[model samples]
Target: MNVTLPPTRSLLVAGALGLAVLAAAAGGWYWYDAQQRRVAAAYAEVMTRVYAVQSPQAPADARARAQQELEQILARHPSATPVGEAAFELGNLRYAARQWAPARAAYEIALARAHSPTVRALARTSIGYAWEAERDWGKAIEAYQAVGREVGPKDFLFDEVQFALARVQELGGQPAAAITTYQRLLKDAPNSVRVEEAKQQLMRLGARAQK
Candidate 1:
């Protein structure tokens, strides 16, 4: 009986193929990481410009430049990790300019792009504020209500959303709803920073929280 041996050339080909696959995977990861780093650097640069506009002595063109750069980031890297944050900054610039329609549009983009719950919540709340700025109480209430429904009570922004909802309801000629919302805030977020404010609002509304 003769013993047959497996071909060594076939074994070498298989090993080379495995190494190639691993090299390809590593190259792909390196490319992704490099792209992310570039996105982060761009985001940081835009944020610096954004924050610079907060100074009372900021240059008149500071906000415009910041807004322009942020828009460029959105246009250039629409699917990047920082796209949502850039959109939020753009929304803030528009909001400060009292461009309510444009502000809400930017915030809508933030909401669509952001993966973080906090960012999404902030964008949603800002949308409500933009409506409030426009004196569109009904739409403001709807936006705030959407936040309440989507975010949990344990979320850090939940109390703020509740307060906004209550305030909008009151201004929208729905005192009963406002009172109920205040009571809900009082119940759901007893230790929130807004708790005292909620109590004051309840008092002014001639309502008390249920035990």
Candidate 2:
């Protein structure tokens, strides 16, 4: 006697297969997410330890280890949330090493991709410093101005941007513009620690305040 599976049996088998597939997909996704979290946690811990090392000598090994861990995280998860932070940290390291162009590129990438306003502002400030170090006054001014506008005047980086803008103007042979920017900065940041320095700069430039 020949035996054949009933339609109900076939339907049940297909349903079970579908459920198994779904369960497998969900399990895989959960595992991948867990791995990502572990990588992120490791990166954070390393970064914290690297930052905690106060002595320059102490930071060398810590920085190297942190960088290695961050590199691994970046390799595995290029678009991860911590990737922007890692790029920013690498930019700082490059800047400290006087590798200006790489530092600037890293900072620009971090600034463009950073979701955190604070991180974006810091990346912008770092890019401006890199441009300033290269004596590219135009780029420096643009970077600082972008930071000031994007991060807003109330951001903690406001004073830094203002100072950078003023310095760029001065170095670009735009003394009058520098003076105007400095005066505005002084007015807006009357109690800023850099206010006295701004005044001295204005005096050196022979800029007379408009009464």
Candidate 3:
């Protein structure tokens, strides 16, 4: 015969199980919070190193050390919230070292991982800069155009990317495309700081501004 527990005893057992689950969930949350804090602290320390490496007076070994630290962070916390920023910083570091291909690779990683639109825009534009530095105008134009297609004109980076694209088009022997891009920039972002420069470019290209 099966024996049934008394009502009060059964209630106590259920309540104990419920409390255990709640305790486990709270413990898990606490651990997660602590881990996030630790990751943030680590990211901050790496940023300090990055700043030092970027300084004009930095030691020759500073960049190498910073790069190592950034790499370690990436290896340890690939899914951390700051991973994209770390990748972007790594790209900037490589760019400063004149490692154009590596810089572009890092920027592509940032583009893939960054949740913030600003960071994504920056990474995309920086990829273009890397190609531009290598005098690969076609690749530079392609990268810069990706920024426009993905981020659009309403983004704060629009005018800057437009200017870059127009400059590259001119460099690549596409004067008509350059002129049109300049005119579009003038029309779309009339109040941008780049407005004066765009106007001058239009004049140089023998194209009238959109007013």
Q: What are the per-residue Cα lDDT tens digits for candidate 2 across 1-211?
A: 9898679989999999999999999999999999878877877876686466434676576666665665566676677777777778878767876889988887877887778878888998999899999999998888888877775445677777887888898889888888888898788878888889989988987744443
For all predicted structures, in order, the TM-scores are: 0.78, 0.82, 0.83
- Which is better, 1 or 3, measured by TM-score? 3
* TM-score, candidate number 1: 0.78
Model 2: lowest-lDDT 10 consecutive positions: 50-59
Candidate 1 local lDDT, 1-211, one digit each (tens): 9888668998899999999999999999999999899888988887887888967677758887888888887888888888887888899998987899999999999999988878888999999999999999999999999999988778887888888898889889998899899899888778888888888888888844343
Task: Give me the runs in candidate 2 sitting further than 4 Å from their true place.
Answer: 1-6, 52-69, 207-211
Error of 2 at 159 (Å): 1.1
- Stretches of candidate 3 above 4 Å error? 1-14, 150-155, 207-211
Q: How many clashing residue pairs appear in each of the predictions shown?
A: 0, 0, 0
The whole-model lDDT of each prediction reads 0.88, 0.79, 0.89
